[model samples]
Target: MNNWTRKHNKFSVQNRLTPTARELWQWLLDEMPEGSNEIIDLRDFNKWVKRTRGFPHDRKTVKSAAQQLLDKGVLTQAKSYTAYVWKWRLQPIRVLMPPPFRKPQKKLTFQSEIPNLDPSNPQPLKDEYLTTTTDLEDAESGEFEQKLQACRKAGIYYYPKDAQFMHGFSLQEVLKAIIYFLFNRDGVRHPEGWFKVCLEDNWAGKEKERHQLRVQWSTEGLFEAIRYCNQKMGMA
Candidate 1:
């Protein structure tokens, strides 16, 4: 039983969402109870996607689509509701739209508003964030460097390929996550384990993002190919 309305197309146009993402948006709207303020678990949403749709979409895909929606301001994460750090998998997300009926609305408390938790979009960080874990060895004074050192000291094993994979995000973001967890900003009891999960999930999301970009790039080539074929046919 789908609760989607024709109005969903408005979201698709507004957000420029892909077909899959548009479908996922409708799915969320259908699953969410009207006038309820509960957080939705991403894992459950992922499972529903696999079962309902013929295509074999995994949880990571749902997560990226969810993040894309979040970025586009279609969805929202309740970072302040939880005592612990609010990474994607660590915490649930909620649809931002108000319920149909009049009900008591909960005030929002966001973790992104927190000091160290507030990192900018994934871009080149300023000079202060460029240092490697090795450079942090002697000084150990700066908070950013200390976090990188702590990740290494925590027995987290990162190899060359893993390092390359993480290169997509600014080193500053990684270090911030580590230190923020250490400070119990998210209130995670096992910071090390949760960080590891967040790292893997974040990397998977980045790879999916890369793949989507590549697909968009290929579309241009596809149009060029069609034009070339038509020109040759005209000549013949």
Candidate 2:
């Protein structure tokens, strides 16, 4: 067996070292050889934990902790190798003592006062006309049904309802049901009116107003409405 020395005091789970995880780390340090950059087998660490630390640890625990330490810059793995080695860059174990108490962070609150608003600023025009049209032709022609099905399997609902309708259902209830499945059932964002137009024009809407509206619908309203509708339909 390799001889090892304590680089730091044993970390405690109860005494402010309560990260719970660092306790295991302390155990690892206790078992490690001093001033040496040698590969520590996970099996050895587990055995050490079981015997000296009186803790129940398995190979998985050792592996997970080793990986976590490596990720946190506490340990470094060799290049072109699978095993991990401790980084000598870590401060000497003496710094592992309990941290000093910090004052609790203060929560901030604000009070609002009503101010008179200027109504002279003109607002942009609200255009109801769609810049692009819904591409019912391709969707209705089973153009992307496979993709739709894959999305369904992945629980990514919220495709256009026409995709379902063209598959052989006409009723509004059925339409709503499909909508529910995509938006509510799988939690996908539904295409808004602008997106519908974009899809119809193959995503070539010219008017800025039309484009802006579509963007809004696609981002804000579509997904939520789909979710709400799906919930109402008991799909979710």
Candidate 3:
């Protein structure tokens, strides 16, 4: 499955918001569904906010974030019946589109419009070496062994130096991602060399995908988890 939250993942960074403001704003984006008119009474919201880490039901902090979004045209607030009812709005996701056609000087070639066939592009390539079942088995024969060995050898060369990283991600988790990438990606000239590169990003893209599907989770899933924690702590 494709990443549904990918577009929203970097929201705070893209908006250049302060840490507290970003948290509050992101809470809004994640609290209600996109393109939704679900209005939260400021009082109820502040009650919930008190259960969170930052902003803590502070009207000044909350309003500051809401106004920032308003000024940036990212959200809107409404007042009706002489009550301060605020609804955090989300901008419709903007998709990148190429400009309208610019007529070519002498018409284009079929190859020009398509992306180059680079492994970095992550497109699947035809396996000219693996035609028959025997050939396929031979190709993958020692690949996993090599990858597992590499994983062990580089046990210290990964994130979560201990299991304290997010959700207890550790060496085994890293190896799983490496193995999946090895099997699914374009041809790798060297297993060890390829895995070395994967370690840089901690194979986070793959882990996030798995987490998304496993929990059927979205940003809102974060809220549910937090709420549970808050309840256990007698804060909610």
Best by lDDT: 1
TM-score of each: 0.32, 0.27, 0.35
Over 1-111, each residue of candidate 1 has an lDDT whose tens digit, in order, gives: 245432344345556665445555656666665333446666665567556432335555665666676676655544433322222221112243333353443444555
lDDT ranking of the models: 1, 3, 2
Across 15-114, the per-residue lDDT of candidate 2 in tens digits comes to 2221223434554555554334554555565565456324445455455655555555444442324443333333234344435454554333443243
Candidate 3: list runs displaced more than 4 Å.
Answer: 1-4, 54-57, 77-84, 95-236
Best TM-score goes to which candidate? Answer: 3
Give RMSD to native, each candidate: 24.3, 26.9, 20.0
Backbone clashes for every candidate come to: 3, 4, 0
lDDT of 3 by residue, 1-236 (tens): 11123233234435654433444445565567555665655555566555532324346756665666566555654433324466555564452122345333443334444467543332232244225535644544344344445555643233321111111123455566656665645665444434433543356566778887978867888899998998999963
Could you tell me how far off, in angstroms, the CA of residue 44 lies in candidate 2 after the best superposition? 0.9
